[model samples]
Target: MLSSSMRHTRPRQRLINPFARATARPGAASSSHPCPMAGRGAATAAAAWRPVSVLDDWVAREARPISLRQLMVFGRSLTESRLISSANYVRTELPSRIAHRLRDMQQLPYVVVTNPHINDVYNLYYKAFDTFRKIKEVKTLEDNDRLCEIISENLKGHLTVIPKLAMGILECRGLMNPQDLDKFMNTILRSRISRRVIAEQHLSLTETYHSPHFSPGAKLSESDFIGEVFIRCQARDVIDRCARAVTALARSTNGPDAQVPAVHVDGHLSASFPYILSHLEYIIGELLRNSVQAVIDRQAKLREKAVAAAAAGSTTSTTLNAALNQPPPPIEVTICEAQEHVIIRISDRGGGIPRDELPYLWSFSKGPKSANRLENLGQVPRMAATMQELHIDELARADLKAPSYPTPPPPTPSPLQQPPSAATPHTPSQQNSLSSLTSRPPNLRLGMGLPLSRVYAEYWAGSLHVHSLEGYGVDAFLQISRLGNKNEQLTTRASMDAV
Candidate 1:
C-alpha cells in the first residue's frame, strides 16, 4: 500500500574511515606515532601540537578509536574531574560568565539563545582540525574558515553525507527530552496514516467485489457469550492504552505546537469484521507514537536555536513564536468492507520515506545506510558468521521429528479378584503428577504475541496480515470466513423469529 514516492534512491557509498581500518590491522607499527609529551614547548608547539595527530597515535596504540562509546566515556570522565583541565579546553575559551548567563536563562518561561555566533565558531575550529587530521596537511585558520564557509553555504549538498547517528545524538540531547508523553502521539499519527494508505490500496485492487451483507438481528445474548466478550474487551483495553501512549509522546515533543487530533470511525459497523477493531486500534497507536517522535526531533533543533537567540538578548522573538505556533502533523484513518475482505487505511502528513530506500523498508535486516556503514566497518563478516550458526541449528532441529505417544493397554479382568494393598496405593499427589507434564501457556515467550493472535483467529478460519514502515508506521489485518449455507438459513429464520 506504500506510495512510489516512499522509495528513495540508494545513497552513494561513503569512503571507509581509514582510521578505523588502520586501528584494526594486525601488527600495525605503533612506534611511528609521535610522543604526546613532545608538544609542550612554544615554537615547536605549533608543529608538534596537532591534536588529531597526537590523539590518533595514542588511540591507535590504546586500541580505542573515537567512537560513540569513547565519546560517552570521555564526557563522563570530564564531568567527574570538574577541574579546568587541558583535555577539556577549547582553543577559543568562552567567558565563564556565559555559563552563569545560560543558567539564569534556563529559569525563563521560554528558550534563550545566548550566542548567535557559536555555530560559526565551532565550524571554524572543525574545518582547521578536520583538514589537519584527515589529510595530515597543515592549514592556517583563514584557509580553513573559507573552506568551512563554502561548505556551510551549500548545506543541501551534504545531506546524505551527514551521519544519521550524529543527528540522532543531537536530537536526543541537544533538542528535546523524549521521555515526555506528547512526543509519542506523533508516532500514532504516522501509524494511522500508513494504515489508511494500505486500506485504500487494497480496496482499489478489489473494486469489483460486492459489499458485505450486514445482519443486525444475529446478535448473541450477553449471558451466553460472556467469555468471548471478555476476550474482545481485553483487546480493546490494549488498544486504548496504545492510543494514550501515542498522545503523550506527541504532546511532549511538539511543545506548544502539539494538537491532539480527533479520532473518527465510519460508525461501529466495521467492528463486525473479524479482528479489524483490535488491529486498527493497536496499529494506529504505534503509528502515532512514531509520528510524535519524528515531529519532536524535527522541532527540537529549531527550539535549540530559539533558546540560543533568547539568551543573547536579541529582540527578534518572531522566529521562536512562529515555531511554537505551528500546528501538529495530521494522521488519517479510513475503513471500508467488501464481500471477501475489509480494508483499513491510516495516513500521515510527516515527510514521506525517501524514494530509493523503499525496497528494503520492510526488511528485518539493517536499514540501507546503516547496513552499508556496518559493512564498511567490517561488521558484515561477524554478522554472516552468526547467521550461519543460526541456520545450522535450525536445519538440525528440522531433521528431528516429534515423538509419538504410546497407546494404553486394555484393563485386565483379574483386577477385581483381590483388593489392592493399601501400602502401595497412589496418593492425590501421585495421581496429579502426570497432569503437571502437560504443556504450559505459550504467551510467556517474546515475539509470540502476534503469531498467537494469528493462531487463535485461524482456528475460526481466518487470515492475518501485517504491514509496516520503519520510520513511518504499521498496519495489521484479519479476515474471517463467511458462514456456511445452512448456518445462513438458520440465521435468517432466527432473524424472522426475533422480528
Candidate 2:
C-alpha cells in the first residue's frame, strides 16, 4: 500500500478533515449485515448505577496532585472491563460514568483566563464535554458509526484548539487556585483518556457487530470478538509520507516563510507490524512538524542576525564567511526493528526546548507556543495548510501533463476498503473521491502533539519519550509494540503497575 505521506502531496482541494468520508453507497456486489455485530450478545437497560466505591475513591483522593500513573491505570481498567462484554452491555454501563465526567468538565467555566489562548483551553473543555454527552447516547452500532462521523467533522476544529488551550492553561495558572488547578488538570486528562478508549472499543465492536457469528446462538471466536482493532501496518511508508508532508510545508507558497529550509531522509525505513495506521500517521506528523518548525525558525533567526551584522558593519569577514559557509544540520530519523518492537528516533539540532519550559513540557496546562506573542498563533496553522495547498498546485502546473496528464497522487489508506499501492498511482476519479479520507498534513500550531502522540503510542502498549539538551537539540523516542495475537481476546495487561 502507498504511504499516507505521498497521498498528502497530491494536487487536491482542501477538505475540512481527513476521515470525514463514508462509502457514499454500499457496494452491490457484497452481501453483509450492518451494525452491532459480534461480541457477547446481551443487553441491559440503562440505569443510574453509580458505584459508591468509585465515588469514595474520588473523595478520598482530595486536595493533592494526581499522578499520571494512576489515570492510565484507571483508564485502562475501564477499557478492559468494557471490552470483555458485548456492545449492549457496554452501552448500558455508559450513563453513570459519563454523568460523572460531565460534572467534572462542567467546572471548566469557573477557571479564569488571562489571554485568548487561555480562552481556547476554556473552550476546548466545552468541546470535550459536548462530545462526551453525544457519545453517551450511542447505544447501538449504528449510533457508534454516526458518532465516529460526528467526531471526524469536528476533529480538525478541536485539534486546532489543542495547542492554544495547552498554552493558555499554563499562562493563566497564576489566576487559578493551586489545588483547583491540579484537580482540574487531572480530571480533564483522565476524562479525555477514558473517553478515547471507550470510543475505540465501540468502533471495534461495531465493526464486528453484524456477522452471523454475533448471533445469540453462535459461539464467537476471538477474532470475531475484536475484529480489526489492530492490524499489520506499514510503518516506514507512513514516516516517509510524514517527511514529504513536512517538505511541502517548508516549501509552502501561501505562508510567511520566504525561504525553504533543507530537509533530508536517510537510514533503513521499510518495516511493518500490526498497528493502526491513522494513529501512527497522526503521531509521526505531529512530531516531525515540531522539528521542522524549530529548524525553520532557528534558520530565520540566524539570517536576521547576519543581515543586522552586515548593516552595522560590525561583522569580521571571517565570522560572516564561516556563518555563510556552514549549512544547517538536517533533521534525522532512525528506525530500528526487533521481533517484538519498532524503535524510531527523530533527532534535531535546531536548538533545544528552553529549560524553564522543560518542567511543563508534557503538561496540557503548560504555556502556549505563542504565550509571549498570541496574536499570530491561530493564523500559523491555517497559513501552513494554505502553503501546502499552493505548493501542490504549483507542482501540478509545472508537470509536463498540465492539461490532461497531471501526475496522480497516492491513494488514501482506508479501514473499510482496500487501497492501491504507491507504484500504481490512484486514478483521478478515486483521488477526488477519497481525498478527504487522506491522513491530514502536519499542523504548525499544535503544541499538544507530543503529549497526544504519547497517548496514541500508549493506547497500543507502546511509548514515546522526549530527551533534550538545552542548547544542542531534542531526541524523541517512539517504541511501538509488534503485532498482538491475531486471535487473542481483549483484556487488560496482567501487570499495570506503572509505565
Candidate 3:
C-alpha cells in the first residue's frame, strides 16, 4: 500500500502561512521599558545583553513555521515509538483546518527522512503551528465552538470514508479469479497487439542502438529480448491507449447508459502473443457488456420488488435505487507462472453460481437428469441395429461350419431374411472408391471454442488444458516447447517488420 504520510515532507520555507512577532510586556518606566542599562546601571547592562542574546538564539531556531517534511518525520517517529494509540487519537482530534492543510501537503512527493530527534522536533513544530493557526482563526467564542464542531464532524466522516476508498482501490486492482480458457484467449488476443506494438518500438530502439543498414546477420543477445519486454511492460501510455480503445468499442456496443468497465492484463511469455491482444480486447468488451446487462437485470428486479412493497405498505423493499447506492464488490486479476505455462486469473465478487447446479457446471449438456435419460434413449435404436447384424453374421458362420448336416435339408426362410444373390467381389477401382467415401471424417459443429483451441495448440505441437471450479472460477493452461534461438530470432525479425 502507498503511504499517505510520505507526502508531508516539504521544507518549512515553502509553508504558506505568515508568522507574527509576540507583543512586549507592560512598561515599567516612561522613557524606557525595564531597560537594565538605565534603571540598574552599566554593571548589569552586560548581563541584560546576555539574556537578549539567548532570546535571539531561541527565536532564530524557531523562526520557520510547520511543514510537511516535519509532519512526516513526526508521524514516523510516533510510529516507531509504538505510540500508535495516542497518535491515532491525535490524528482524529486534529483541527480540520490543520488536517486539511496536512492532507494537501500529503499529496506532494517527498524523500523519506529519518533521525528520531529531528522527527520529534518536526512533530513539535506541526503541533505548535496547528495551535497557532487555531488561535489565529478564533476571532470570537462562537467561532471557536463552531470550528470545534466542524472538525468533529469531519473527523467522523473521514474515519469511514478513508478505509472504504482504500479497500475499493485495492479491489479494483487485485487479482482474485482462476485463469481459464476464456482468460487465456483474452490474454493472448491482447498480448498479440501489445507484442506488435512492442516489436515496432523495439525496432525504433534498435535503430538508435545501431543503423538498420547494419548487417541483419548481426547476432542479437538475450539482453535485447529482455530489454524489449521490460520497455513494453513499463509503457503505461501504450497500455492505457489500448485499454481506451477497448473501452470505446464496448461502450459503442453496449450504449452510453452502460458503466465504464475495468480492464486488466496478465500472464507471462505465453500470454504475450500477437493474436491474444485482439482477443483480449474483444473478450473484455463482451465481459463488460455482460456486466452491464447483469446490473440492468438486477435493477429491474429491484424496481418490481419496490413496487410490490409500496402497494402492500411494507417497510422492506429491495429497489434499484437502494442497490445502486450500495457498494459493489471488487474485480480482480491474478497472474502466475508455472512450469512450461502461465496463468492469468480474473474474478468478480458478485453473486456466485448456484451451489446446487455446481456438479453440472463443466458438463457439455445441461438440465435435469430426466433430460439426460431421454437423450440416452436416442442411442438405444442404433445399438439394437448393430446387435442384430452381429447375430446374423454368427448364424451364417455356424451353418458353413456344419456342411455335412446342412446338405441333408434346405433351411426355411424367415420373414426377416432376404433372397440370396450371386456374390460379386469388389474390384481394385471399386475398393478404392469405397475407401475414399468411408475415410472422410464427419464435419464438426462450430462454437466448440475449447476443442478448437486445443486443435490449434496441437497444430503447433503444444497442448491446452482446462478445468472449471463451479461457483468459484475456471483455470486453463497452454504448454509449448521453448522456442529455439534461431526460431526466436526469426520471430523477432518478422515481428519487427510487421510492426
lDDT of each prediction vs. the true structure?
Answer: 0.28, 0.44, 0.28
> Which parts of model 1 are misplaced by more than 4 Å?
1-241, 249-270, 276-282, 298-316, 355-357, 369-499
* Candidate 3 lDDT over residue span 373-443, tens digit each: 33333222211010011122223232222111111122322111211111112212111111211111111
Give the best candidate by TM-score. Answer: 2
| Cα displacement (Å) at residue 108, model 2 | 7.8
Poorest 10 consecutive residues by lDDT, candidate 3: 484-493
Higher-ranked by TM-score: 1 or 2: 2
C-alpha TM-scores of all predictions: 0.28, 0.54, 0.27
1-499 in candidate 2: lDDT tens per residue?
1123422221122212111111222221122322111111100100111222333322222122122232222222233224334343334333333344323322232223313453444345444434544455445445655654554444334444434544445555555554555445444443444443344444444332332223322333221112222233556666665666555555553264334444455555656565543456667776776777777677667867886897799997777767665566778888888887888888988788987778766655445453533433444432111112223432323322111111225323331121432211342222222233223333324445575677666655678999997777889989887644322111111111010
At residue 148, candidate 3 shows an lDDT of: 37
TM-score leaderboard ranking: 2, 1, 3
Q: In terms of TM-score, how similar is model 1 to the real structure?
A: 0.28
RMSD of each: 30.6, 17.3, 34.8
